[model samples]
Target: MGEKPGQYLLWNELRGDWCNYDIVGEQYHGVAIYGLLPDDWSREGFETQRMFELVPEPANPHDRWAISVRADGKTVGYIPRQDCQSWANVVRRVAASGLIAMVPGRIYARDAKNWDEWDGENDPPREFASTVQIKLGDPDGALPINNPPTVPYTMIPRSAIVQVTKEDEHTDALLKFVPGSGYGTLFVTLHESVSGRAASAKPVVEVRINDERIGQLTPQMSQRFLPMIRHLASRGLVTACWGDIKGSAVAAEVRIDGIKANEADEVVLDGEPVTLPALIDKQDDPETYALPGWIDMAVQTGARHSYESQPESTTSSTPAAPPLPPAAWYDDPQNHRMFRYWDGLRWTEHVAPKVR
Candidate 1:
């Protein structure tokens, strides 16, 4: 009656025929008849047959009224209603396995079957699954990506030469020679630990010769003395000798030799007297003095005036003129009378009296 509730009939365009089918349950019902001419089929040919036969006489009491279709009698499509409740279970399994493909704006027959296959090659190979091919800009030559190498150094020898000696009780240290490429210097180092501490911390004597300075314990002394040594050595006077005296009084006397005869008059020793020969050697009136070392002592008289009366002659021959008041009465500034009156041991307080 109403198209047998769930039975369906259709024309196959590829096969070119009206097909006859019944819906019994999940399985096919009575028999399917195909290749029916559309003009010869009754208006409700298969639908009228299924409602009376398969709907009322199912294989089991619960077998639903359903429609099944076959391409060449292998059942491929179905629809369920009424007595076939298990037909719903078959439709759910087909939907999960993707038996149907839905496209928008298209309609499909209720009994259309979906067939699709999946081969395993669309996935990556197991070994290379974790890797990917990344394209860098371009390829260059293979260069090392690590560290570099090392170099070496050389050493040279120093050039200054030095020597030390003892002259008398003092030390005569020398900076003998430096190389021609001379960095001309020699440092004289005295370890204070080895040489005992000085009795007086003050420098007793410090001297420098050649390119070396000796006996300088302080930095200020070394700076002042070392440059002096360099200057002296450059002048070719490289010898510096000194004497240390341990006595209460240290005196030095310098005797200048080979002095000219005229020059000797100007040489005055602090406490010594100048002799007559020393002075006469420098004078132009050489013949007026007897010997260069002697003094002329002869006395002369002046001519008398005849108009004046002469004194009377007496027995003592003028009474000796009272001894001329002794030559000490004449105050001659050039006589050096104070030296002449010395008694060989000490000076006398006597001075020659002034005379007109």
Candidate 2:
């Protein structure tokens, strides 16, 4: 599998709840949010995951990359500023593409009242402390088996039809080198150029075979792919596909058919022949393939550019120091059978035996 982007923990006390996690068995890498708590908050609501959205707040005067975690339209807390910088590109691109990013969020809390072992050596505060942990990772980290995974995609009703143009010379060269077949395998690569082009010309996706450029996807098709391409570019990866370069010097053609980005892994990783399923028409499967209402509204209303062009404010403000990670049961650094409790500041004597 591809190297994962690595999970990160967001625990800023100022914006969310204290990480006073009660259980020794459960573990999470996420933010701790302040939310409703029962009178006996500790014993309830542990491990029940809820879906939450990560919404970008580019206009927040203090930080342009502020990302708020929300559930059912209620704001839980912000992704810590430091961590937001790492996630800004992905979140911004998804938002700009008119899609919502959702992840599972779980609540962790401790009720000291129910500690069966009343020794009270490492007594937690009497007041209830609840934490919300929402794990974060690359959307497509489990595919391709390369250093970096293939580009990620959200499905649309149908794949964009792109005709590859300007392939006459390239096709002639290929036909000369590999005479009889009159066909070759193709892959996708994107190129950016500012020379002799309009300022607004977007990057172009080229169809290639063995480093030789065969043709290019049409402008409209490139636009449809820009969002996914940009996201993969940011992670030092490329959008890839296994396609066919057919026809001869007279008329060359590149065809990817209905291959989705998610399915590119098998083709790119194993060199397996790609077999795409039939396209689902919006009319035939409106419930499954129809464009969402928000997307329609976004296309009509238009969204602000993903990046701001304004200069940074002259007003100087002190950057907040990163907060300590929430206290929780962690694997013993010394390889003990029991888990050690980290008290936010340092590892303490408190330990709990491992339990399934």
Candidate 3:
């Protein structure tokens, strides 16, 4: 199946010693952006306060990754030289998508903003800069779903983002370090493996922050969400919220109907919004007398136009192109057994839904 490129693999869902991790990716987190440098720890980084922009020289656009930070307007040295081109490419890919979206990032401390630490010049420029880390989204975001696209454990609850609409202590806790006004979705991850060790596997969903295991799904909560979690996970819209309810027991609340079919009139695949083609062609040239096959081809093209023509014609702005088709299940263009939904117009929310 054809997949968009810019997507960098952060990690995989494989768990336990039995799972082979033959893939070795850049040491950087998520996508192309790398992390806080030890020598660049002179100051602390802010949450999502300042926006970031990519600065590349026309001459060495790929080779140089000049990220400019807003606020006082500081230009950091290029990302680690080794990762400079890679990081630049990711930004280019995202920008090229033409989607106004946010990618994950982290700013590390620096010994001196002026000095180009990676450049190895003790005499750093007097300009200000910070080490920035870029992170990619789910590495397997584009992988084909296995037959029914089984998710070993329940996926994160997207509805949780709305059910508990307001920002609360729980949401704040997970994204405390992340800057800007942002929200975090609570997800359940497993903690068991084939070797019977503490690894991400099946069943028990784990909860933690910064590698600190804080909680797990309480039996009561699991029983409540198990079905919905499975159903939503299949739809590729699974979401949930977890918190310390009582005595370290993890309690969760989920909302299912957060998907506003209209919120996005267009479809977004791989973070890029896409327009849909007309399901039925409204206009075509009259069948050519030269070819007998032309007539059948035109009839087989399905309904050709909207608003059946009456004997008399009335003038109206070409029947506002049929209200974009409703999002519906269609054979997966990428994978055969796995069908994806054309939400009326664009690809969306695929899961273990029974295919007709």
Candidate 4:
């Protein structure tokens, strides 16, 4: 019989290992062994050895293999053919099964033990173990949030004059002066005389100096009026007051920068009225404000027809022509009405009046 199918051992040339054969009376099956070999026995070495032992034992061992060739005249160990195949199958099955079993309880125990041993007698703070927390609340309920109230402030010019009067028991009339680019004046009037009494019935005019408390004023015989006002004026302070006098007012011209006033029937500065005209001119001509050099030129040229000539259709009752074209219409400086003849270059002397 040829070498028994299952009873023989062979060297796996591809994997460089020895294996066993399975013989079912006639059929053959392969079995592999897990082991190492001397480096000199592999193809990468000398390639002189063709086979190696499958098992270390001889008679009736679990698996056995033959040494077919010796490369360096040295001998190694043996392996059981059946055991080789079984070992290979077990390795393959274990590799294919993806389940990896771990012991969580054991791992935790080990970690705890290691930690206790690594850090002794001291521990981290308890607060450090907890995370921080934040809470948001509504803003409108006495808390700072969106949409807070705002107060606005505006600056008044130093030149502006202000007037104050007692309008009623609760309110006072305030007259204010506004200045234009330079110095201005304001005037005020009193409706009733201040009572020269010490009783609370007298009106009180309290003046503040640059937001600092200075002094108080009530029309009284004991108080010095002009000296007090003069002192306040010299110090560049703004005055405001409250009291019982009606139609009582004050006015003055204060110097300030970058303000100009126009002539109007009534001028109100910072809510106070000014009666004086801010600008003045002596000329009576309505057109004087609209045209330049009009008055002087009118005297030189005399009144001329308003148009080029009377329309051919007009009778003796026709209106005169419109005035001559402006002096700018002449191309040359010498071509004034005194020098140039009309040659159709411009309107005829009959059409346009000559300058004297």
Candidate 5:
């Protein structure tokens, strides 16, 4: 059988022994960037942020755990040796699910120029090296589920779709029990290797309805999820979740509705807003297609308070200042005929003439 797309888990779920690492990558150790550095324009500017794609290089001679970082479709560097092992494992799991492993990275250089322009004899402008900073771990739980379930735990998060393989053998038996609604819950159990197959490194999870065996998770999947399934079994929790049965009795396929690698936690937003980043595609905007970027937006409104009525003082002695507004284009205080960009803090030079 062909390799099925791997299941996805939140960063927390992907944080275990094999892939639990976070570090700022070292770029100059082997001149990793070499000829791949950003163009002259970028080198002559301030720090630039890019969405870096992490590609695992199992065949790399120097380090089998090597992970190459790419930006704008060109190689920039590699994940530091100290963290690549765990990072590679995480990348594999993420890639198996058909999603690219990407993280935000900053490319910066000294003096904001390709080469030092200092002509002074004593303090010859410092080094001209460029470095990129990346963080693989999501320690603060900032990464949310791609498709959260309506009710947590009872069903898998909508993102994980588990299929019961080898359903051909059980099709006849499944006919009678298949409900008219075509939906039912299946109990998951990790069992020893099937009859003549090689003894698996980990136990295989079997999917069953009532007492009849329907099918089992593929060998590859069993190994991928063995860790979490074992954890639940150790806690004496019954592994059961919803599934949808489709196709005629001649040959039926069972697909898990949702599943989770870890148990869900209680979430309370209070009155604060939730903000998320998403990659956008605008048809009319051709530049966006050439350089796609994540769009950040507030998904909820904050609770209104009396403090909002108070005017913000540009110079205040009090340490407790109200939160800054989200980054956006607003009327320029100094330039009445134009609008400047506020990047959640100080005003930026980016501006547009006020629309009449």
Candidate 6:
């Protein structure tokens, strides 16, 4: 808020993630991990639908979001400070992670006509970086739209290679699909159970291969992952159930196929939104909105930071999360034909069509 200070603590509650912040001059200052663009980024000229990414610089200790800008098949520059917040919010609301992680947005170009001025980490980046100038809405791209029928959507595997290890503990527990010793594709699905008490419980997504349910991803991991998988399924790109095993003790105790990085879209596949991801709760299970930090100024009152509903519940040992809600197929807000399970307190990764 002052002096474009070096990256400072700036917490966002919507995506349920925090990062450092620093302002730029005009104001554009500093930079983030650089991505190189095609030489023609300065050649073919910037156009409509040029994409951008909100990359968090966690190592900076200043939580700076370098609005990664891309054009003509290359990641160009970044969004200048004045425009970042507004666009970031627009992308956050609709996305599950709520961090502007990677929804499609664009920027346009008006005054600049250059071919080599971008500050990528590549050699001679400073020469290009110094010549670069970005203004608000320049090379603007369309905001995210619903899965429009006319506009085709398809899945491009987030990772070219996904290596799943079969030596997992659950792989042994479920004996049906695990590789005998070597690694193989352990096809898992996002599962929901209607087998138990109907009204008294709602089941979460279990990671199952063959017929046996060996284990499940953590609640938070499942929640973050479900939307992306659904979006891909809608496009017919992803065929596996949306499943990830992280964000809780289940991540530590259970052995599922391992992903190399954190919060990766392992293709059942693909997605953070900004403002700690707004937790969705109905009238009955509103999570306690508690804050643990302090405000720097007198005018800024109330809690300084917030957290999402506990990632894990008390009775987490069993198949269901604690205090399971009445088990019934509830409406899936993301899709009309399918319904999500409102397990009382939270939405489970499970979804089925009302007709199904």
Identify the leading candidate in terms of TM-score.
Answer: 5
Error of 3 at 198 (Å): 33
Candidate 6: lDDT of 98?
A: 24
Candidate 4, residues 1-356: lDDT per residue as tens digits?
A: 11111111110111111112321110000001101223233322221112221111111233222211110111111222433332322112211221110000000000012252345667621210101111111111111111111211111111112332222222222222222212222221111223345664554444322232222333541132333232333443222211111122343222111011221111112222111111112123222222211111110111111123322221222122222221211112232232222222353332211221
- What is the descending TM-score order? 5, 2, 3, 6, 4, 1
> By TM-score, how accurate is candidate 5?
0.31
* lDDT per model vs. reference: 0.20, 0.41, 0.28, 0.20, 0.43, 0.29
Evaluated at residue 13, the lDDT of candidate 6 is 12
- Model 4 lDDT, residue 221, Cα: 18
lDDT of 2 by residue, 16-127 (tens): 1222222211112111232333344345444344445565665566676666665443345567766776666445444443344555456655533536545677773343
Off-target runs (Cα >4 Å) in candidate 5 are: 1-45, 111-127, 138-356
In terms of lDDT, the poorest run of 10 residues in model 2 is 298-307
Residue pairs that clash (backbone atoms under 3 angstroms), model 5: 6-96, 156-258, 156-259
Clashes of 4: 38
Q: Cα deviation of 231 in candidate 1 (Å)?
A: 1.7
The TM-scores of all predictions, comma-separated, are 0.12, 0.30, 0.24, 0.14, 0.31, 0.22
Stretches > 4 Å off in candidate 3: 1-51, 54-77, 100-224, 230-356
User: Model 4 off-target regions past 4 Å?
Assistant: 1-176, 193-198, 203-356
Residue 174 displacement (Å), model 6: 9.6
> Residues 12-81, candidate 6, lDDT per residue (tens digit)?
1111011122223210211111122233454324433312333322122222323433222122344555
Residue runs of model 6 more than 4 Å from their true location after superposition: 1-69, 78-188, 191-206, 209-212, 216-241, 247-356
Clashes per model (N, Cα, C within 3 A): 5, 0, 21, 38, 3, 42
Where in model 2 is the C-alpha error above 4 Å? 1-45, 112-126, 139-356
Q: Model 5, range 78-120, lDDT digits (tens) per residue?
A: 6778767645444554444444456555565543221455675
In model 1, the worst 10-residue window by lDDT is: 128-137
Candidate 1 per-residue lDDT, tens place, 1-356, comes to: 01101111110111101122223222211112221112243322222111111111122233323323222212222333542343322222222222211100100111212123224446422110000011111001011011111111000011111222221223333212221222212212221111236773442113333223333324432332344333333443221211111111221111111111111111111113211000111122222222211111111111111113322221111111100011111112233221122222333343322111
